[model samples]
Target: MGLHVFGHDPSGDTALSERALIEAVDVLIFCAPIRQTPAVISHYVAQAAGIEREQLWLDITSIKAVPVAVMLTSQAEVVGLHPMSAAPKAATLRGRSMVVCEARLDKWRPWLEDFLAATEADCVRADAEQHDRIMALVQGMVHATHMAQGAVLRELAPAVGDLDGIRPFSSVGYELDVAVTRRILASNPAIYQDIQFENPHVAPMLERLAAHLDTLRDLVRQGDDEARDRMRETLLEQSRAYVGEQAIAEGSYAFERLGYLLADLHEPRYISVFLPVDRPGSLRALLSVFEQRGINLDSIHSSRSADGDLLFRIGVSRDGDTLALRSAMSAIEAEGIGRVVDAPG
Candidate 1:
């Protein structure tokens, strides 16, 4: 039997109308939209006063401070969670980050940890104020930068093709930006709207982002040796120094890894396969087919298909034997392990 759920829709602008959501569960999580989050929590809190049980309250919003504060108004244990990722297409949040803010936790900390553990997310704890301040740069400035890039690209669509059409000439940086911009555009506009407008720190953060951009524009116009030196000093050297060496090293390594992945993805010689069974040894069995055929993979990445199948994209080396790759695909299907959804012609 399926588990009964009692939360309001995250996409909805309205607050919870039902009191059962408050009385029915030990934890009242308001998944409602950001603009209406307070009202939703208020509805729960007003009804919650009559109940005697000490419950827990949590929210999964991007910005935490306001929600955490509102949640604190209740007599319940309060915590705010921010899953720093686009919605998951898979079951687990293993590779994704989940920020936890302990606002009024006493008995709820263990419960929160248990819940987080089940999600398999990389959990980090911070206070509500600290979380919002950092999100100002991470979410606000970053989103604004891409949004501006998207608008500029939209304007240039008449000369160059829009996002899809411009991909043929996209550098790795441009390609990555395009992907992020597309993701933001595709999601609910309200979420982005609230992130920019609601977070108190965002407005000031945007000003700093704009100032740096304006400085960059002026430096490019000057196009002198002094301008070049100033650009490096302000944009590169000083910023790098402030960022710290450990962070710089980590970020540099991450970029290299992504670069390698992108290079493999761009390869023309690759095959997309999907295993039917959702069990252990399925992937091992599939990989063994390639290994047996002496087909060395250039890159192997997993993603979900349109129908929610676990699809694996395997990139073959340019100098590798195409016949072996074809045989491997056939073997996978014949062994009743997986089917090749895509392969080079």
Candidate 2:
């Protein structure tokens, strides 16, 4: 068994240059941060002056398309691998998945299988482009959406530095929210950035996401019963287009289990805003200002504070011009009562 360590070049770990390493090895395993794959590959190739194409080259990268493309063109035979989990302290990979792409199964099947068997991992094959596209939605959009929610929550309550055990939260919904928060908070920013930006397929996925939200926002502002009904019909129709009608029905049923009514209404999305209110009437006073401006109350939810203030989620119909609505709300004399927040750009 032959192995070598390649720490960061500046960290003073003594290792051969890229050329020496590539030329001297029969099997080369390249492991670097997801964003540093191109740089590492370039350096290794530059140093490997007389290396032949017969060497077994493998890269463990988060996104596979770009790396696979680069490796396939190199002199060496390549196998793209993505380990499904990252554990710095774990001793064995008992239940891990190794995503493999562009594998020469006919030539190296036994060697590859035996390597995975020793590590106790299952070798799952996938197409390079397909894997990245799936990951764009699975990792990119999901993480970005959760980060947006966490940002909205923080803007609502600037005082609460952490949310380990927040109360008055729904049992099921709060548990899911906590999981989302933890997942995003524990991740590296550069990894998320590469996942979002590297894959070409992600641009269209994100475009569709923004377009869907814009449609929903516009529908909420119209507020006509007929228009709201039409919007629901359109949304259900769109969902059925992707998932079958039965699947759409099943999803609607599942959503109900989490206490969501799924009513079609033109209500402004609310974020929890914490501000000082002397009494119950103070909340009502803010509501009166909105009511006077022809904003109908779709829902008004509240949370209490230790100093007698209440955090109100005043959901009102989005009517009139957006600028006019903001100006009207800003004119309220009560300092720090509420503010209209801009969604993530």
Best candidate, TM-score? 1
Q: Where in model 2 is the C-alpha error above 4 Å?
A: 1-11, 88-96, 103-106, 159-166, 236-345
Off-target runs (Cα >4 Å) in candidate 1 are 1-4, 9-17, 160-166, 306-308, 319-324
Tell me how far the alpha carbon of residue 206 in candidate 2 is from the true structure, in angstroms, after superposition: 0.8
What does candidate 2 score on TM?
0.62
The alpha-carbon RMSD values of the candidates against the true structure, listed in the order shown, are 2.9, 17.7
- Give a tens-digit lDDT track for model 2, residues 1-345: 135544435246457655666666676777777767866776666656437466777888888887877666567777888887764233446667778886543456567667767777667789988889887887778877777778877776456544533544346566566577777778787877887788787788889888877888888898899768878787766667889878877876786653342232123453344445445567766776666777665666654444434455555455544554564456553455554332111
Total clashing pairs for each candidate: 0, 4
Clashing pairs in 2: 19-47, 19-48, 53-75, 220-266
Steric clash pairs (candidate 1): none
Error of 1 at 84 (Å): 1.0
* Alpha-carbon local distance difference test for all models: 0.85, 0.66
Candidate 2 whole-model C-alpha lDDT, 0 to 1: 0.66
- lDDT of model 1 at position 340: 90
